[model samples]
Target: MAKRSFVWGLGRYLILATAGLLAFVAVVLVALRFVNPPTSAFMVAHQLSADDARVRQNWVALEDISRWMPRAVVASEDQRFLAHWGVDVNAIQAALDEYRSGGGLRGASTITQQTAKNLFLWDGRSLFRKSLEALLAVAIDASWSKQRIMEVYLNIAEFGRGIYGVEAASQAFFGISASQLSPQQAARLAAVLPSPKKMSAADPTPYLWQRVRWIQQQMAPLDGF
Candidate 1:
């Protein structure tokens, strides 16, 4: 009887602890909807690893950014951004199918998922990390507006080794502010997003230019944004 009682008590404790943690996460997500985060998990990680290099990031309102920038990213990263609810099931299935057919495994993370990972999680390909990222993405999607998610993503996304956000990236690459970025400049910046550390928006290789052109072509359809 004592052994059974101990097991039941431990189960109850685990359940209560899980509930408390979930409640805390809910409260934080709700608060972040209104407040601009001072720094994200990615930024902190970058700073810690940089040894002394500065991480540059400038927060700007959605209105302060060129309309082209958002359209370009939406085109390049997640075309179904406005339609999907946090996760893109079709994209995930497609990626899995490709992997099964002897193709390399690729990511199908949505903008919301990327935002959640950048803001709160570490960089990794582990299943546990992916699951946590997905849960956070759903929570973030439920709490924030579509515009807010884009705004936060644009600000927190890594553009170069130390550069983050449209504002900093634009200045570094084009000698212009994010608001002054032309369509070509925005497309170039968006093109480097897939591998920001390796790809250079300032000096595009032939391959990077191809991505830039593709992103530019895609931007036309999403221009209404």
Candidate 2:
């Protein structure tokens, strides 16, 4: 009888703990909808790491950034950014189909999902982390606007080793503000996003240039969002 009672009590405690955690997360998400985050989980990780170089990031409003910049990233990273809630089911299905057809595995993470990962999670492919990321993405999408998601993503995304955000990246690579970025320059920045550590936006490789051209071509339809 004592064991049964203890089990019941433990179950109730667990349920209450889960509910409290969820409520806390919801409140934070809602608060961040209006308040610009000073730093992100990834940025904090970089600051805490033993790396000698300092992390660079400068927050800019969506309007402060060049229109071409957002369109370039939308074209390169998530073409369906305006449509999806958080997850892109069609992209995931296409990726899975390609995998089934003996193609290399590809990621179909949406902009919101990437933002969620950068804001609250670490680098990993564990199932638990991915699941949590999806939930966070949904919460963020529900709480924030499309423009807000883009603003946070552009600000927090790593553009190079120890360099973050379009503002810092523009200064580091092109000696200009993000607002002054030309279409070609914005495309170059978007090109390095896939492997920021390995790829240099300051010194574009042949493959990087190829990607830049592709992104530029894709940017046409987005019409400088």
Question: Which numbered prediction scores highest in TM-score against the true structure?
Answer: 2
lDDT by residue for model 1 (45-78), tens = 9988887669999999989999999999999999
The TM-scores, one per candidate, come to 0.96, 0.97
Model 2 bad stretches (over 4 Å) = none
Global lDDT of model 2: 0.91
Candidate 2 residue lDDT tens string, 18-38: 999999999998888889888
| Candidate 1 residue spans exceeding 4 A from truth | none
Model 2 scores a TM of 0.97
- lDDT on C-alpha atoms for all candidate structures: 0.93, 0.91
